[model samples]
Target: MSKLQIESALEILLQSLQSNSVMSKTFFWNYLKVFCKEGFLVDLQTLSIALVEKQAVFLIDSIACLDYKAAQQLDILVLS
Candidate 1:
C-alpha cells in the first residue's frame, strides 16, 4: 500500500477501535499481520491509548492472535 493508503487505513481502523466494533478488532488483527509482513511501523502509543480507551474484550482477543515477533515489535503485549 502507498503511504497515504496506509495512513487512511490506520485512521479507519482507529475509528473502528474507538467505536468498540468486534469486527474491527478482527480487521485490526489482520492489518497487524500485514504490517508485520510488510515491515510497517505503527504508532504503538496511539494504538495502545485507543485500545485502553475502549476496554473491549474483542480487542484483547485480537491481541492474543498476534504472533510473538509481531507483538514484540509492536510492543502490544501489554494490551493482552
Candidate 2:
C-alpha cells in the first residue's frame, strides 16, 4: 500500500487502541512491543496476521537468569 494509506490505517488502529471501550492496555502494550521488535509493523496486513498467531508468555523475572546455574533455576521454575 501507499505510504498515505498505511499511515491512515495505523492512525485508525491507534485510535481504536486509545478507546477505553475497545482496547485492553496490557494486551495492547505487549502486542505493540512484539510487533515492533519482530519488524511486523511495516505493513498493516502483516500486523493483522501476526496478531492471530500463537504467543508465548512467561514471567519477566522467571526469564532473567544469565549464567548456567541461574538458567537452570529458571528452567526448573518454568517446568514446575
Candidate 3:
C-alpha cells in the first residue's frame, strides 16, 4: 500500500481502537479484515498479534462491542 493509504489505515485503526467497542474474536476479526482490505486499517494483523505478542493485560485493554457506536449509528446494521 502507498504511504498515504498506510497512514489512513493507521488513523482508522487508532480511531477504532479508541472509539470502537471490542467485538468477539470471530466478529471483530472478520470486521477488521474487511476494513484492512478496504484501506481503512493498517497492520491488520496487529489485532491478532496483540493477542500473542503482548501479555493478557495488553489484550485486555481492548474495548467491548457494547461501546461501539458505528454499528448503532447505521440503522440497517442495527438489529434491534
Candidate 4:
C-alpha cells in the first residue's frame, strides 16, 4: 500500500479507538498484531505516541496480554 493509504487507515483506526466505544481486548490486540506483522512502522509509531499521549489504560493493559513474539515486535517498533 502507498504511504498515504497506510496513514489514512491508521487515522481511521485511531479515531475508532478514541470514540470511547467498548472494544474487546482480544480483538484490539489482534488488530495491533496485524499491524506489527505487516511492518506498518509509521502507523505503529503514530499509534504508540497517540496512546501514550492520551494515557490509554486500555493500551497498557493490552500490552500485558501480548504474547512474547508480539510484545517483542512492538517493543522494537516503539524503541526504534
The C-alpha TM-scores of every prediction are 0.40, 0.29, 0.32, 0.39
Q: Largest lDDT belongs to which candidate?
A: 4
Write the number of the candidate with greater lDDT, choosing between 3 and 4.
Answer: 4
Off by over 4 Å in 4: 24-27, 42-80
| Rank ordering of all candidates by lDDT, starting from the highest | 4, 1, 2, 3
lDDT of 3 at 56: 24
Over 26-70, each residue of candidate 2 has an lDDT whose tens digit, in order, gives 555555455344533344343333222312223222223222343
Query: Which model is ahead, 1 or 3, in terms of TM-score?
Result: 1
Q: lDDT for model 4, please.
A: 0.52
User: Candidate 2 — worst ten consecutive residues by lDDT sum?
Assistant: 54-63
Per residue, candidate 4 scores C-alpha lDDT tens digits across 1-49 of 4555555545544556665646644454567667546665434555555
What is candidate 3's lDDT per residue for 1-80, written digit by digit as tens? 45455444434544455555555345545655565356432333343333333322222223223223332232222212
Q: TM-score of model 1 relative to the true fold?
A: 0.40
Query: Is 1 or 2 the stronger prediction by TM-score?
Result: 1
lDDT for 79 in candidate 3 is 19
Q: Residue-wise lDDT of candidate 1 within 22-66, one digit each (tens)?
A: 787777667766754563435554444444554432443444465
Q: Which is the winner by lDDT between candidate 1 and candidate 3?
A: 1
Superposed on all Cα atoms, model 1 deviates from the true structure by an RMSD in Å of 6.3
